[model samples]
Target: TQLLEQSPQFLSIQEGENLTVYCNSSSVFSSLQWYRQEPGEGPVLLVTVVTGGEVKKLKRLTFQFGDARKDSSLHITAAQPGDTGLYLCAGRPGNQGGKLIFGQGTELSVKP
Candidate 1:
């Protein structure tokens, strides 16, 4: 079974601060995705990284894939209260029957 581990399981910061979250695994993945979720709603995909060393940005948020495809990171700059939510990283393990292995999830709170 594939397992993903996330670091800094919980984060709290003042508005306009910067933060970074990490997700790692020993197994390689076919593709990896980042998602943002709010209370009472399903997670919304933020970005997908397929190639090693790929980077994607959505406004003040940035996502990066590790060179070996075994890790990923999300960075938020000038975070605001609206950015407070659950962040998740999920991976499609190589030949793993199409099931996604998800990280433990990061619960972030940005206080204004």
Candidate 2:
């Protein structure tokens, strides 16, 4: 099974700051997805990156997939206090089963 490694285990910053979280793997994924989970709720899908070098933006958050499709990054601009939560990166690998492999997670705390 391929492993997804995410960086910056935890992040804390003032509101309006910019941040970037990275997810990397040795295996390429067929589809890579990013999700955000609030304190007591299940994660909600944020964005999905499929094509290599594809870039997608949702509001102030931007998602980018590496040319090799083995790496991805999420950049949030002017992060707000409401953005505090756990961010996860997961994907159904090209050769893996139906199950998705997820990163350990990155906890973000944005203080007002």
**TM-scores of the models, in the given order?**
0.97, 0.97
- What lDDT tens digits, residue by residue, belong to model 2 across residues 29-73? 898999999988999999988999999999999999999999999
Model 1 alpha-carbon miss at residue 108, Å = 0.4
Q: Superposing every Cα of model 1 onto the true structure, what RMSD results? A: 0.7
Tens digit of per-residue lDDT, candidate 1, span 29-109? 989999999999999999999999999999999999999999999999999999999999999988878788999899999
Model 1 pairs in collision: none
Q: Which ten residues in a row have the lowest lDDT in candidate 1?
A: 93-102
Superposed by TM-score, candidate 1 places the C-alpha of residue 46 at a distance from the truth, in angstroms, of 0.3
In model 2, the worst 10-residue window by lDDT is 91-100
lDDT of model 1 at position 17:
98
- State, as a TM-score between 0 and 1, how close model 1 is to the true structure: 0.97
